[model samples]
Target: MNTSIPLAASDAAATSPTTLIYWFRNDLRLDDNPGLLKACQKANNLLLVYCHDVAAWQMTRWEVPRTSRHRQQFLASTLADLAMQLKSHDSRLLEVEGPPAELLPALARAIGATTIYCEEIAAPEEQEEVAALRAAGLTVETVWQSSLLDPTDLPFALDDLPDVFTSFRTTVERHHVLPPPPLARPQKIPALPPAYAALVEKWGATKGAISSGFADAEPIEHQASNSVTYRTGGRSSFPYFLPLFSGGASAASEHLHQYFDRKLAHTYKLTRNGITGVDYSTKFSPWLASGAMSARQSYAVLKEFEAAHGANDSTYWIWFELLWRDYFRLLHLKYGPQLYRAQGLTSLPQPSHDARAFDAWCQARTGESFVDAGMAELSITGYVSNRLRQVVASYLIHDMGCDWRAGAAWFEAQLIDYDVYSNQGNWLYIAGRGTDPRNGRRFNIQKQAHDYDPDGAYRRLWSAQ
Candidate 1:
């Protein structure tokens, strides 16, 4: 989340102050926020709110937890960090437990604010939330801030986005496309209105503050990771139990600097595919997934590192991986609700979902060693390696003959870094759907295990349970 570029104050700063509501969605940090920054510039007294969607905590169609306890624990850290930042600026974030459309309108009326501003999410359910908000007769403004490259800067229209990733990459590279510089955090924030207290009392809206005692605090050493029914064995690749790998902008920025200072980018391509430990990968996804880190901030720092040292193929590979992330997001903008369909933009018939087989896969009761081991690690740690993700996903769809959507739902439930776009896009690609012109992937599990887990280290690491 570190940015090297100099930041300028907004030209459209502080227009006729009005009471407004700024809803915090995926983009949590204030450091590089376009939506929150705009809210600050226009508001005299702003009500900051975040809603814990009931649906997020409920069961999915696949009969798995939509979001796991561990995922919520990590989110609690991020929310705590956000609250501390707001507190520094003499503001408070109201944590409500309900859907946005239901809670926000009442909260907006309570605060006497007619408009709600937030980040735009391109997924189906999120879009429905926004549409529902508009139907309630409120002005809701959404900013597109998640992507590194601005969609307006693209050489081609979204409707014409290349079907293949290679074509998309070459087109952008050919145009020498670059993301806009990261913005500075707002130095001065508007004060809360006198009505805020009455509003909170009248509506009884702010139920509880999860950020109460954990803001920027050190996590206990050797403490058990708070997960579902079971605790990790302390061999997690992405260890959320420790403070270093904990969720927040501070940790994310520190981790980013540590990765670059140690010059890991120079050998990233070589180590990226390794399926063990935190050192094998950049491990930036969790922060990025939660919006504690911005892709542009990471890119800006990468450019600085390249300037300080010399550029190489390894450094370029980092950018390559980032583009892959962007491509999946753009796919959402292009296909929208179709991406959520079972066939996923293909002429193929609906996928056959073996519920019993899927249950075994989810419980790690599947006899396949590599796949089960990977599933076990995910269940325990709320994370798994990118290589193993591909291997296990393929094993479920191609080998076990289970539905790809079922695997995606399980990932949605477990992954602390569960990204909707990437999860759906990758699942579609593996299932011979989505935008893959060559039609889906079918990774050979035996070959993958032999190639990556040559000495059976990864499998043995999670073999016992």
Candidate 2:
């Protein structure tokens, strides 16, 4: 059995001996990926690898798994798709479960790879990994692929990012750093050796064996699952808002096309605050959060729609939401450790801890029926509306007085579309320690429930009322 499948070209000088390793981190798709393209152009042979970091998965401080089965299933589906795509280019994704710090360098040595390419991550732990790779003398190149506007094109230095969302938005709007056009997908990918194919197949067959590599760190018990539900987050998962939509890069693109082509951009503002139904909101956040869809792609589609259909406040609000996402990312980069602290970005003293109260909140036993309903929904569905997210997050931090980090970490463990920057950013904001100019703006739970769920339909659905 020839495991080394020839994809694009087989006759390209096999004896050149230099290989390039493309490390697939969060950016899984081949479309609009600059790092993958650059790596392919530079090397005679390409070895694509997805390292399932056991250390990262196992080191959860909470009882919940850091990467939920919902996320795992989505990633597995994504990798399966990526493998098929790579085969079209004469490449394959070599899946391995281990610390990349050890696995990557060893694989590079084994393949005689001269360069390793991956998407750049700004989070503290991911940066540490990059530093460790450099310390090992491997030539690692990282490209910024997640953000809509490249970091280099930002209006100011990263350290100079504004402390307020409004200020950051104003600066960007004034200077207007447009996102670059999406990168074209390549027609072909370089090939690997027959020995590499055999190694990958053997590795895939015994992936569970390497589960030990990530065993030291306890897995957090996430409530989300891969079973088809309205809240699932896989390629085949139920469509939330925009039931016509699917869950992946291709689906997102199609949604954008119809929204723009049909001039539906004009009604975005009117329907955005809607609590139910698929078309009420853009429904881009889940994929955007996971790096399956880029903000720039959304922007481009919206612009095309506006050109054909004419721009309006509704059309602009989509950009406004993207700006909010960007604002959160910049906030994390600026505050760094402050965002992780107990008091958050605020100078206020940290809230007192109450273990029993915290447990009640987590378990949906809180006496506040509305709050409990939101909690139950999240526990069962792995999702809560943005309005409810604010309500529950505030109740957890202010009313219950739990550690904000604990709540954030729990969100990290459960959310299928959790982004480190957004998860931490929103948690800090709710804790009254973030960039929100109004400090400690805790939501009134009863008032919110009455307002958003007047008939108590939502509460009834979750069995919390």
Candidate 3:
């Protein structure tokens, strides 16, 4: 029952001229990706492939769409940027629409691929994809490159990981664990074989060969609207800080540099809780979640800034948050599918589900102004502050008493930067079903508003229109 997949021996032992398929999953960027580097090293000819999950466009059990237009558009932009980068390096991204389990094996066979290289995602659905590919006799090479700290450097084994964040952080810090410096971007990626490229184009062109419905789907633009829209630059509303916030590796790196250049990390702890505007927090989560930004890359830059600017609590806290990210990733290794259960990592009876209450929470008709404002922002822009997220999540589970998974699923559907590990872990934690020491976390909505939005500015800003 061991689900932690290792790179196939055949793939690892691969030498000499060979055709390889580099399947892009969560790790979308070219920089600091060990899997992509491995692919380049092994590939005489590479075929870059991205399969859009057709299931992502459909509704979940909660009745809301699994992925919103904003997230889908962001992904499209990311793919387009990746495609441009590949072309510049004598390669191209094959964008198709279908389950990776089905599309990948067929595509690999069609192109004479012997191996596939991809990021190792521990979640059930992602894991299943790799298993299926291997079952099809393709050697799949999976890399663990998502966390700031590598699993090998952890103070304990995955099964022995600390149950709480504080203990895990303290132990790692005590052991002086540091993430390796970010890898430099590859100068040039291996080119796809001309014949393979032609085959990819041909398969993509075929209607029934791939997920035909969204194969040629286009990236959507941010339109200005009163309800849900991407236009965020204006008074009386929290501006989205658009044009600069496009999804891609370049954009992620640029924003990281700009944040440090402007000396914004110094005040991150102070303003991270603010509900409105772009400057309130680092806003790196979206890129980081989407794999446009590497946790190690961001950590390396943070250390460089601290070396020049001197260390402070804020700088240290940024790294602390990253440690939390790593902690959840490790927790996945420990608990596996238990993290997704109704009573996650616990033996408590399942939490009750209420459809009507859940609908009200999702619709932002929860009668709590702060919760409504946060939900509205998430609905409209596909973004919300960390503080707002906790507030809304607490309100949903504690005040509304809806199933935590329902709320987690809603966030999954709407968030532009959704990461499965963090999304599920956080939801389970708040619901008292995961690794929370106190069992469950409850927030006082009135007090949260009074503290974070004293003048009711955030509530007024989002509630209007």
Among these predictions, the greatest TM-score belongs to 1
lDDT of 1 by residue, 1-465 (tens): 977664454523434458888888888898999999999987888888888877776677888867775677788788888989899888988777778999999888776788989999999999999999999999999998999999999999999999899999999999999999999998777788667777656543332432222222111222344542235556788887677888888888999999999999899999999887888889999999999999999999999999999899989999998999999999999989999888889988988878999998998889999998999888877889999999999989988889899999989888989998899999999898888877988998889999999999888988877
Query: Residue-wise lDDT of candidate 2 within 66-133, one digit each (tens)?
Result: 65554554555556667777777767789987788988888877777757999887787888888888
TM-score of each: 0.92, 0.86, 0.91
Better of 1 and 3 by lDDT: 1
In each prediction, how many residue pairs overlap at the backbone (N, C-alpha, C within less than 3 A)?
Answer: 0, 13, 3
* CA lDDT, every model vs. true structure: 0.85, 0.71, 0.80
Predicted candidate 3 versus true structure: per-residue lDDT over 243-303, tens digit per residue = 4677888788888999999999998888777777778777788788878899998988898
**Model 1, poorest ten-residue lDDT window?**
213-222
In model 1, which runs have C-alpha deviations exceeding 4 angstroms? 1-17, 199-231
Clashing pairs in 3: 232-239, 232-240, 432-439
| TM-score quality measure for candidate 3 | 0.91
How far residue 69's Cα lies from its native spot in candidate 1, in Å, is 1.2
The window of 10 residues in a row where model 2 has the poorest summed lDDT is 214-223
Judged by whole-model lDDT over C-alpha atoms, candidate 2 comes out at: 0.71
